[model samples]
Target: MRLERAVDDFVVQLASERGLSANTAKAYRSDLDALAAFAGGRGAHDTSDLDLELLRDWLWQDSRSGLAKSTIARRSAAARGLTAWLAREGHTTADAGARLRAPKADQHLPRVLTRSQVDGILDSLAALAATGDPVAVRDVALIELLYASALRVGELVGLDLGSLDRSRLTVRVTGKGSKDRVVPFGVPALRAIDEYLATARPKLAARNSAEETTAIFLGARGKRINSRTVYQLVASLLADLPGTGPAGPHALRHTAATHLLDGGADLRAVQELLGHASLGTTQLYTHVSAARLKDTYRVAHPRA
Candidate 1:
């Protein structure tokens, strides 16, 4: 089969059979499209023309073109997935990318906020909510739940009214790979949610002429809030704060996890709370905690 056709089929299988998220499938598709273009330029237009050398050269070309190591690594993985699928489905005689490799991604610690910085952000949001504006009230609930539960922005925006268990102080969120887990939030988050539900959601919902949305958070247009809006809200809040890296909602997630570790939460429990499939993923917070402690020691130790 044509390489492009095979790439499309593999992407469909990723979404349908493997149940990968749309964003993940899209990323794979993007990388494979580039590979298909590269292959076509070399007159290797069919899956049979694919070879390990071609795959390695594709990665080498990308590296020479100045793609980040992380991006190149992801591209290599995307190619491997495609070639493996092609071989499995009998399109190729061998998995050409079975031994394909790329430079390992650079390890940069995720941006985590200080506890005092988080408190100051919450205080400002609460003060805004005091004005009785529907959007302001919703923002309070949104940020509170975000920091409280360390929810991914996609998961937070995907929440519906049925997702919350108020008496239990937990929310049912469908995370990456469509996995659902119940995550707990603090009383402060509950208070903000209650205020939003009482004074904000109804006002926003009233503006909708269509059937009422079951979404827990509404956009300005009364539809379910989208991830971009949530990102903008977080970016605006974090813009003035002193930090580098992304200022998006995931910073709150990193902050929450690091804080949990600093407070003596078990690695396994945090792994479960964050819905991470791997314990190693959750362990990144321990490194963040250690870095913070070392910074404190450098600043406060009189012996130095």
Candidate 2:
């Protein structure tokens, strides 16, 4: 098959049969498009012309272009996935990217908020919620649930009223790959949610048609909230905090996981809570916790 058409088909399969998230499929599309472009420039016009060497050449080109190691690694993985799929589906006799390799991605510690900083953020949100504006109340509830449950922003925005189990103080969120898991929240989050449901959500929902009533979180126009909106909300919340990592909604998730580990939560349980498919994926929080502990000991210990 032609390279571009083949890539498009592969990405469609990722989104449809494989159930990859839109963001992931989009990334694959970008990476494969670059590969197709590079191959086209070399007079290699079809998937058949793609070989292991060409795949490695793509990685080499990206490295020479000053792409971050993580980005280059992702590109290689993307190519590998596509080529493997092509071979499995009978489009190719061999997986051209089977031997492709890229530098390991640098793992920077995720930003985590201190306990007092979390308390102060919640206090400020609570005070704003007291003003009785529906949006303000909703914002308070949103952040509370975000920090309490460590929900991905996509899961938070995709939530429907029916997803909540009020009696259990838990929410059923559909995470990446359309996997659903019930995540519990604390009393403070429950209180904030109660207030938002009682006073804010209804008010906001009333502004739109009845068809828009199912969403748990609403935008200013009373439609279901978007991930970009959540990013902005969390960014504003973390703007002044001392941090070097991203200030998006995942920062709250990282903070929640680190805090859980710090408070002696079991690692396997935390893996389940965070919806990580692999234990290794969730173990990054242990590193964050250890770093924090080392910093504390350095500051408090009398011995140099």
lDDT of 1 by residue, 1-304 (tens): 9999999999998898878877988899999999999999999999999999999999999999999999999999999989898989999899999999889999889999998999999999989988988999999999999999999999999999999999999999998888899999999999999999999999998888787789999988888999999999999999999988899999999999999999999999999999999998898889889989998999999974
Q: lDDT of each structure? A: 0.94, 0.91
lDDT of 2 at 181: 95
Which pairs of residues collide in candidate 2? none
Candidate 1 RMSD computed on C-alpha atoms after optimal superposition onto the true structure = 0.9
TM-score of each: 0.98, 0.97
RMSD of each: 0.9, 1.2
Give, for candidate 1, the lowest lDDT window spanning 10 residues.
Answer: 16-25
List the candidate 1 regions with Cα displacement exceeding 4 Å: none
Residue 195, candidate 2: C-alpha displacement in angstroms = 0.3
